[model samples]
Target: MSGHGFHVHGPHDHELEHAAHGNDDFASRIAVMTAIMATVGALFGYEGGATQNDAAMFKNEAAIKKTEAANQWNFYQSKSSKQNLAELAMVLPGADAEKYKAKVARYESEKEAIKKDAEKLEAESKEWEEKSENALHQHHRWAQAMTAVQIAISLAAITLLTKKKWLQYASYGVAGIGVALAGLAWFHI
Candidate 1:
């Protein structure tokens, strides 16, 4: 019975205080870990979105190039048809035979030029397709990373709820995999 009502802690009180301190420390660790996981998850989500956008852009470019190549082929076919008509006209009666011959020569030269252009367009289209495929592959990797990070975040939440140290470790393992996948995506391999 002290006059100030300030008593010294007994052994039981000391043990309770130590346990409370430990619980607070554990809660702090969980909070810190959750925060870190959330930050990384957000970054992974953003990168996944960006990669998907890049893939879509590349795909659209490929489609455009393919359309251009198709158009060039169509033009080439039309020129070929015209050249055929000119050859037919050249075989006709002698009234305009020389003129038809000159026209046939011009059409042959035009066809040659058109063939070169169409070939160039086809090559360009193939290059675009290759680029698009590469982007898509990278996008898939990024998506996988995003998924792993999301799972890690969920596991972290569960760890907090269940107070399971094993779950926390598992969350870290999943997060590591996510980070690795993100690195792979960066290299676009």
Candidate 2:
């Protein structure tokens, strides 16, 4: 049952044996190529995931800045409105009462508009952070899956090159499937 240490067809067996050696070399080459691809895919996936995480962090920082700016604007507007209302009440008295009332009303309206804008900016900051975090999670998942696939492919390639019948039986077609998945992940990254 072994191809080595025995010959049944004399010179023809020698030719067939030489051909099998060539096949073995071809299989080894394939295995090496598969390993290279797997390694590259794993590296790319890892880096892509890390980059996504950095982007998420940046988004969070931006969100924090926006919220802080909005809060500061609101505080400033509230103080200014109160001061203006007090000054107008004292300075106008009975002579320009209606004019003071109109001026105060406009100031109140402007303050309310600024308050709405600050709220809107705060909401937008939260939304941006959430979106960035989601993208980071997706990239992390993709990287993990690709790493597992690459390991599987490397194992399969080793098995194929070694020409162990048991390994072959256990690993046939695995390298192909792993490579395909790796390629898909690479494209995503």
Candidate 3:
């Protein structure tokens, strides 16, 4: 007891003080490693979600393009039917042959335009489908990266609990794989 006051310290004060100062090197390393892995995992998870959304958007665009192409094709088919009717009118008795010829020509021209537009839309649809596929592939990569990082964090926790040096190394290895996967995802590989 001091003259001014009595300050009683608990028996585990030394251990508590050591922890407060981060004196246990293994524990500090595991803590830092766990924090880093968690951050990386979160980032990977966010990227996976974003990529999934992108894939859905691209797929929707593909579907819209396909519908537009189908409409154009329907218009082309209608023009073909009109042109067939006009050709038949040219040969029918008591019909305006010149007007029918003009009608046929106009329908053919319109059909050509519609065909081109339909083909263009079909190509756009295919492109959108390819984009959607690529986005989905990237999303998978991000998800895999997130999974690896999560595994690493779990390993780090186990290392802290058991004080196993080998588990720490394993955690580091898994974390490296997670980072590599993240890089691959960034490159869209």
Across 1-189, the per-residue lDDT of candidate 2 in tens digits comes to 346777357768887778677656656755665666677566657766675877678697767869776785867578576758755685754657766667667777777777777777777777777667766655665566566556656566666657665654444345445455545545654
Model 1 lDDT tens row, 1-189: 566997876779887787677766655777788788788878877877887787788778878877887887788788788888888887887758788778878878887887788788778778877887887788788888889888988888888879899998998899899989989999987
Better of 2 and 3 by lDDT: 3
For candidate 3, give the lDDT: 0.95
Worst 10 residues of 2 by lDDT: 169-178
Cα TM-score per model: 0.83, 0.56, 0.90
lDDT against true structure, model 1: 0.82
Q: Write down the lDDT that model 2 would get.
A: 0.64
Task: Give the clashing pairs for model 1.
Answer: none
Each candidate: what lDDT? Answer: 0.82, 0.64, 0.95
Which portions of model 3 show Cα errors greater than 4 Å? 1-22
Model 1, stretches more than 4 Å misplaced?
1-23
Worst 10 contiguous positions by lDDT, candidate 3 = 1-10
